[model samples]
Target chain A: MKPSTVPASTPSLRQSSGRYLQTKWKGLIIAVPYLWLVLFFLIPFFIVIKISLAESIIASPPFSSLLNWTEDGALQLSLLFDNYAYLWEDELYYKTYLNSIKVAFICTLICLFIGYPMAYGIVRATPTQRNILLILVILPFWTSFLLRVYAWMGILADQGTLNNLLIWFGLIDEPIRMLYTPFAVYLGIIYSYLPFMILPLYANIEKLDMNLLEAAAALGAKPLITFLTVTLPMTLPGIIAGSLLVFIPATGEYVIPDLLGGGNSFMIGKLLYSEFNNNHDWPVAAAVAVALLILLVLPMMLYQNVQARQVGVKT
Target chain B: MIHKRSRWVIAMLCFGLAFLYVPIFLLILYSFNHSKLVPIWGGFSTRWYTVLFESPEVWEAVMLSLRIALINATFATLLGTLAALAMVRFGRFKGRTLFSGMISAPLVMPEVITGLSLLLLFITLADIIGWPGARGFTTITIAHITFSMAYVAVIIQSRLIGMDQSIEEAAQDLGAKPLRVLWDITLPILAPGMLAGWLLAFTLSLDDLVIASFVTGPGSNTLPILIFSRIKLGLKPDINALATLIILTVSIGVLLAAWLMWRQEKQRMQDRKMASRTDH
Candidate 1:
């Protein structure tokens, strides 16, 4: 191919006005999505923040901002930190936040452990079986999520199918309280999010080099050593992806905890819902949400940094 | 890696698979259970399935939900593909990074936050414009479209990124207008991604509970909302029956899609083999 004959400042080298218009139109087409996101997602987050700083009034339009204490012992227009204090100083609030993170972390660990193996197994399987297993993982996802969770209720309740089966087999003296327990809550979350964990792991681990394993064998490394030295490091990307998939959603989960968790079992998500709906306290709820966002942001930023580093290496 | 007994690995795999399948199988079995107390088998019966057919209110809700999901899925797929096309065609610009981040945000943002934000927007809109929203099914459908479109956008973007861009340029060189170039070339080429996006959005709309619970007003219960409320009150065998029906339908749809793809691939291989033979 010949190099360009035109000099850098030549008129003939300039792009046409018709092409310029097309490029500008194309730029607007790109702008539409970003504009929609700013309006819907980002602006609402600021509004939530604004309202969170306001005084809590009972059940009568929660969005009266600019708060300060008045002569009549009512709060008026100015700034305050009590809503955040309600989230932090209270033992119940801290407990709920800890509980949300605790559950999400444990669930992410379990999902990684379980889903990684299955992903590996599926990748190793014949194409037909791989397709079949993948379909099995995705099939439940296609059904209504609440209905699938409801199906768990039928299996986990005191007089549930699991108990009845145990009773028939003479394995239990009484129908166990499997429903409305923390264990039951964990079961539901793990079951629901298993597919999320599997899919990401599948995407990454499926690309792993089989020759490495063979080479390790030829080099006289034991199976376990080879696994630790080769496979785990190789699959770390998949592990991170799978963990993120499980961890992020599990943190903000409301339905599983609400249905399966009893009154004493207070996850942060449930607490936020109650504050908004049951307690009619919007400001406190917003404060809790802001705190939740803060808690998630640190780890999420770290994840992005790591991903960016990886992309930097690749490119 | 550990060189555990193959028997041990096999047993573990079997147990896990059995755990997943048995719960679902039990749900199916209980659908026909004569016992109303669910799980306890009073006897074998077809009573729950029959009960499903008798409820006109249930039918009405299902029909309404179907209508909403179809509408939401179609719009989500269309907007998602357009967004994806714009994303890929306009590859890199000043704000491309910002655009990608915006599209991915809804996928990660909590459903509670999404629902509440949408609800707040609707209320503000009513105060401003006196609009066509009491924040009912229409609001819920639109909200569903917003998030579901993100997923569709992701899928279509990946598909477009992997695709050959030369085909479109070829169409343009053959004297196609920009609109006609897209319609005759890109639309047909991206049809599979579009269809996949439609299915993804439809499933997402069907599965949504928290967002729908927030936005759905005045007696409109999608099946998930109905099931959620019912489970909170107490479990029922009819739910099992309904779930069984849904599971079966989805499995069939997936299997059909797989079979079609396999046939298409096989035909492609045959075509290649024939062409190579002709060349030889």
Candidate 2:
């Protein structure tokens, strides 16, 4: 998006009287969000880093002091690398990290598969139909995300709707154990995030110039081939945006796995929760959060770099 | 023929939409099931709805969630609009890139990390300053505003970028001050976007569970927390009833908003047509 920084105000008016007032308003406007982010967003991350370097202790607040005042009025400070070391030493942390990534990847792929066609169809729809279809896609999204995950419990449980239907049809001798499985976790993730995928994709696809596809068709290209060559390349940005939207949150997804995944499946979000709430290891939990943030941030920064390069090329 | 491929795409779309809605439909359907055991076809009954209404805890949680959502949405919209204005109106401020990154980061930042870091911040603040005394509604609302503002910022930013600057310039040329132009011309034009951002933030805060879980104090459970805690035991009919009611409320709200937007769009189109006729 292009930035419209220079407001097109009248120069004569600005020179006469509004110059001082303009700068003052601008200062106030900038200060509000700037100060809010610094105090709430930036300061919290610094605290996270500080806590991650502190020792774990069994106490009221559960983490050891980063700074200690000695009995003789001297000050002592401690920062432990032990929490970071434990992350490397333990195999489970890596596995949890990999598992989270793997699930996130699979969920992103599933969302893309399901979301692309919905977006495509909505774009192809007549104008009124397009609005209705888009609304349908977003309707479930506005409902509670937690409740949607809970809804899957009613559908995928052993005696739930799907299993009951399967058993009634004699397709299975017993109710299939579908709930509390990785399959259900994937289902829950896809169901909850489908709108996130579709909305972005729709925004891109709806604006597609149909004349390009028609020209391809006129050049004796098959519909499938035309879509593959012409449509897919144009919507690649949408695909990436949607995938990132799904993939990022899915990586640290606690609710779906916590509610749906069985004992065998573990996620970093769950691990972080247990470390803090269950084991009272605040510093370790902080370390895990720091690690997860690192895992998420590197790829995000790389994506931003690639996007900036693409925009540069375009310009 | 291309017709066959289009048919397949249409089928896929139908199946995809069905997959999306069927689970919600079942939840709504089974809400009326009289049986205590979920998913069983007990004849239709309103027992669960009545039970849900009778529960004080649910009411308390609902009220708390609404209040947080209200406050969070309002503050997020105000701050977010200001941030968007800063990015779009003020050209090259120091830390521009950092400001933009900070604004967008929370949109994709994992809730676990945000919740944990914010919790630690609150605790540290309380320890050092002895203010905020405890983590409760105020803390949760603050946390919600911190993240939800990112979403609001993106919305208003895009809206402001798309808006025509000539109108505001016209107002300024008429000797109106900068703030007056903003109030009389810019904000009125951005009203729809601001409202949309506000509603989006409200829903997001209401739906949040993880961050609230981290920040909540004693007796401060939000509805999502209440419902999630109960899920471990087993599915309850009352929870289903609660979900159904929530879904109903949301659907109605969404439909109303859509209708209003559609009407506003029509009005804009007519206004443009009338302007063109007079020009001719």
Candidate 3:
């Protein structure tokens, strides 16, 4: 180590100064995004909660304030459970919630059934071929979402392409009522979200050690047994991740259900839309939002805990 | 690796791809259909395309959507890049987990919840600060940036994780300032990831309807919002024409990007080979 004779201001001093500046820059870099998210993402969530507790009024902005000034210069607060109570009282809300969950769950299962094998096959393909297959899977994802849904309308209408094809094949006498039904809603969701399911599952399955499967096979394990015991267990995390990705968004999907699901197919998203836009009830809309948030976030909170535990074990 | 079940798996994959593409293919094909009704095949014509070109409402929506998408993609990329750097490079800072969670929340949060909460926030902010006087372009742009940033952050973070850190460290060791190192070395290497993130953000902003619907005021109709309302009434051939044009434009753009990246990779490999030969 140099003991002496080094200049005071040449390299070492400048380097330390640079390090100090770098530290300040680091703080600023992190703070920008951190503060932006807090201001925009986190604080808005609180506002939603506040609005949900307030009463809807026929006024500008359309919600009564929860706070009031008292005659004695003290503050008064009023919060209403009426919106939530109304949500509970209405049997339609219950049906909407249950229907949304049912739709989301079924769509998720369909995505898994369709996506898993594709992912498995792609992972096992030659490297060059795998890239092409992955690109093909992602191509539709880049296209306009609303347009994709609209494409289904053209294909599933009473006189749509599917019915036309079936009629031509002598499979049916009349045009089947495929559009404006729960079945169309299911088809739309599965089609839109299948890529989301496949990508994560592909990532997980691609990382698997093929030797483990080969070892099982050498030990007289059937292909089905090897897959069930090894592959399925190994990709459970991915399965859960992919399922949640599809299911959560599907639950709150407004576009697909509104377009494909006729008046009878009640979804919470469509209900929330009507509450806000048609009914002009901001508080009820907020309440619906809160209910949906809880429905989605509870599973996520549980998943987070499970993930944390898994990380802990791994470390 | 070819097994007894490989054939079944391959067949499933083929079926899945066909299922995914057939509808989109039909939509494109029918865009040029001369018939007013979709299923009945009339002789092919360019009438719908001409109609789409002449529609002022669609053009207005398209212009507005493009403007928002441009602005949203830029802001999302900048903020998302910063957030990704914070998560990847800042090590274990305080509140890192919270920071990450907030960044990722929009990824899975229902669009309805996101839109509603954001609209509420804008309303409250306007009441308190008297800014953002109305919900339209500004509010919609901000909402798009918020959610799209999460996606951009994920893309950039994955890219950062795959990158070699030694090059950046070496630049710093050679007396380059941190900012200089980032600008010169790190950013150049991250350009592809950043471009991908930008494109992703742009497409997301363009495709977004639910959030835009929540935040937009009158006269600020985005393309998706316009198409959505129109489709609710009925599907038209002009709409199909517009969709076909968009798909064509987007696919060409994607293919061009892929080709450019492939060329760049090849050039890099050739350059490395030359450098290795010179070294020997």
Candidate 4:
């Protein structure tokens, strides 16, 4: 549960050219990861910004050159706000984004609902029991995620397991349509991301330091009162972190919405795919991507602030 | 004694497990169904598995996915290990937090966004440089490596942060150069963490479908993509058979790991007991 040993390098380093060496090495250590970010993450984002300003093209890969202003004062390039206008005017992209966010939000709530009790139950169980429960939670993850989603499709289709069961039990006259519905999308998203929610909640709950709740109860607090006063506040950080992990990814999830929700899932991931692969509208896709970046910007900045605060570091 | 409320809690947990596992279990069970209808109970048969193996296209997609996963795992491990080492070994720089944040961003960013962004990059790159002529295996593998490396780095960095810095300092004091200190002191300590990170990255890449679908081009489909397209049309029982095989593999792997850890824990306890006896 805790690290058993601590390395003694600090004292020795402090004895020798310490501050200078530490400063230099720390700077160096941070650079390798920094460069990767600049190249793969940041640069790609900047490029998307640049391309979003351009006109759509029909090529193997779709992008156009930057529109530089003329030296004499008149604008030289054919750059315009067509893509942004299109996103506003066209009903589909905005609808997709809205739907994706809606699904992610609702799924996050269900995951929290299901996961909280399970997490609490495990933490209250014996350590052996907790370990077994945790494994059971993670075991499904070890299988191929796509294949598992595929399995869900087989189970949820009109003629699938639920329908078959209904007929066999004589509960229904005809099979109910399930697959390709928004309900199916919700099912897929919740099922897939539930583990992401549970693991963090479980980690925080298991380390809840039961003595606090026990002391509160001994002082005459009810079980519900103690949980509200003691347990809930302590696990706020983990809850936030877990939701970010689940909701962010679920927003942009492709396969689940694509398969279970079918073509009409109206998720942004499928829409982005359409712009690039089907619609051949690169500029529009890039612009939608810019919208995505803006959407992610606020929460991501919040996450950064939290990370900096974790080590008591100022940023 | 278990409380009344606790039983309800456990029952709730059991329902969650059913929600998670029943669909997959059903997938496995129905793999043996002799009929094409997924849920209809037919006489048990292994024909689907045989048919799955016989399909060359499926095999090729599986093989391609394997190759991509192996390559991605290798690159991710290397970059992640070095980045992790740097994060710990190097002193905190002006933008240390920023760097860490950037590297770890992929872990939380939606694979959809990551894929979308990367695909846009590939297209933009092609327009600018005319290299990587087409977005296919190479591009997809590169994309996987980029994200997987971040995960590996995070895991390895956590391990390095836990490690005692004194061991590496001791090596340095004993006439070892910086590189030699790293090679001897740091690497041995980091090996287990890196290996664990590598396996984790491998599994993640193998499990990816959303991102792969975004970045993958025509005629270069990965197994997950292939399976997904088929499932979209409708799930075949053979898909069930495939899921069963994968489940078996992971179950066996986890069981073996648990056994090994148990043995090591027992040995560690015994070793401590002997050491205490010697002191006495």
| Candidate that scores best on TM-score | 2
By lDDT, highest first, what's the ranking? 3, 2, 4, 1
lDDT of 3 by residue, A212-288 (tens): 89999999898889989999998887788788888988999999989988777789998998889899899999999
Candidate closest to the true structure, highest DockQ: 2
lDDT of 1 by residue, A57-115 (tens): 65447655576578899966676678998777899999888888999889888877777
Q: For candidate 2, give the docking quality class from DockQ.
A: medium
Instruction: Please identify model 3 stretches exceeding 4 Å from their true place.
Output: A1-22, A71-73, A302-315, B265-280
Q: Model 1, stretches more than 4 Å misplaced?
A: A1-28, A67-77, A299-315, B1-9
Tens digit per residue, CA lDDT, model 4, B1-280: 1266678888889999899989888888899999988878889999999989988988888889999999999988988886776665554556767667777778777676688788777766776898678777898888898899888987786676566666766766777776666677778878878887888888888888878887888898888888877777887888788778878887788767666766777899999999999999
- What's the DockQ of model 3? 0.58
Which candidate number would show the highest lDDT if scored against the true structure? Answer: 3
Worst lDDT run of 10 residues, candidate 1 chain B, spans B1-10
Which pairs clash inside model 4? A7-B164, A25-B90, A25-B91, A26-B90, A26-B91, A26-B92, A27-B91, A29-B86
Which whole-number lDDT from 0 to 100 does residue B225 have in model 4? 81
- The candidate with the higher DockQ, 2 or 4, is 2
DockQ of each: 0.42, 0.62, 0.58, 0.55
Residue A193, model 2: lDDT of 86
State the TM-score for model 2: 0.94
Clash total of candidate 1 = 6
The per-candidate count of clashes, in order, stands at 6, 0, 0, 8
What TM-score would each prediction reach against the true structure? 0.90, 0.94, 0.92, 0.90
Q: Give the clashing residue pairs of candidate 1, or none.
A: A66-A77, A66-A78, A67-A77, A67-A78, A68-A76, A68-A78
